[model samples]
Target: MRPRFITLEGVDGAGKSTHLGFIRATLLTLGIDACFTREPGGTRLGERLRELLLAVETEVSLETETLLMFAARQQHLAEVIRPALVAGRWVVSDRFTDATFAYQGGGRGVANARIAVLEDWVQQGLQPDLTLLFDVPTEVAAQRMAATRELDRFEREEGDFHRRVRAAYLARAADNPRFYVLDSTRSIADIQSDIAQRLAQLAEQP
Candidate 1:
């Protein structure tokens, strides 16, 4: 099978993180070489930027924040994602450009056109072969997040902000044939079953 690029996306607490291990294990079990990584922290420079971006006390202008995201992504693609795919490993990322569109464009009111310009410059024509969107109600997502861990700056945003993010994600999913939206409100086993099927199909793809 040709190496594939996959990205997992969701609003905070939509349970995307909970399923990463399952996806990795399932791929390994299927004998597919896969590398799992996350955006904004896949490279050393990106990790430093991620720390600053996630710090609750840190404040940044909307445009600066969006630019920073793309900067990190540029480095990530060079140092992690592209190399993995070139080496015949399926590359799975925790989040990608979709998160930028959702958080900056939808949640923070940055224009989509501005984001698209950055996306084009940084990614060129590269795009995920598959995007797994784990979707859930904002209320349920917030509740799940609160029960699990202390909130980060982004996760601590108000309900309305999160709602916009969710809507933005669904909007992107609707327009993209590469996306597979998963209802994360289901049981873990059920979700993983669905994920396994998706990975199997990818493996079988010519």
Candidate 2:
């Protein structure tokens, strides 16, 4: 049996990481061997790349940022994700390629063509079997983020940029049947219930 590749994605403060723990617990209860990981820091090389990408003092161009993300992703896939999936261990990720498309392409106004090229080169047609997109209004997400940790480079962008990223995510969800978009403004327990229900449904599918 092939293991499931699941990814959760959303703008900052959408509570993705919070839900990951719940999802992992649920999977364990079902007797599934699941592994949790996050992009840009899943491996040693990836962690270094993550620091460069998120560091407040470092200046990087849009193209440079995109390429570095892919570099980290490649190492993450080779070292952590692919092997686990091949061994029939469920792999859950906090974010994936969708984040790059949202932040770099949509928010930064990078060309879609350029983004697609890098994605293809790095992913080599790999995709998550299921993608749960936590959807929320830009303002709601921003306010939540502000209340939490200090802003990262991407999180410090203007409201309009985040709006564009949200729009892009919606468009991507529309085109992809594997995507499950959920209203993230709900309570954590409610969101966890919804996720468990969705996972059960997926498990039942032929």
Candidate with best TM-score: 1
lDDT (tens digit, per residue) of candidate 1 on 105-147: 9999999999999999999999999999999999999999889
lDDT of each: 0.94, 0.88
In candidate 2, how many Å is residue 45 off?
0.7
| Tens-digit per-residue lDDT, 1-206, candidate 2 | 45889999888878787787788888877777698899878999999889889988879888899889989999999999999987889899889999988888888888888989988988888899999999999999999999988998888889999999999888899999999998999988788888999887766666
Listed per candidate, the RMSD to the true structure in angstroms reads 0.7, 1.1
lDDT of 2: 0.88
| Predicted candidate 1, C-alpha RMSD | 0.7
- Clash count, predicted structure 1: 0
Clashes of each: 0, 0
Worst 10 residues of 2 by lDDT: 197-206
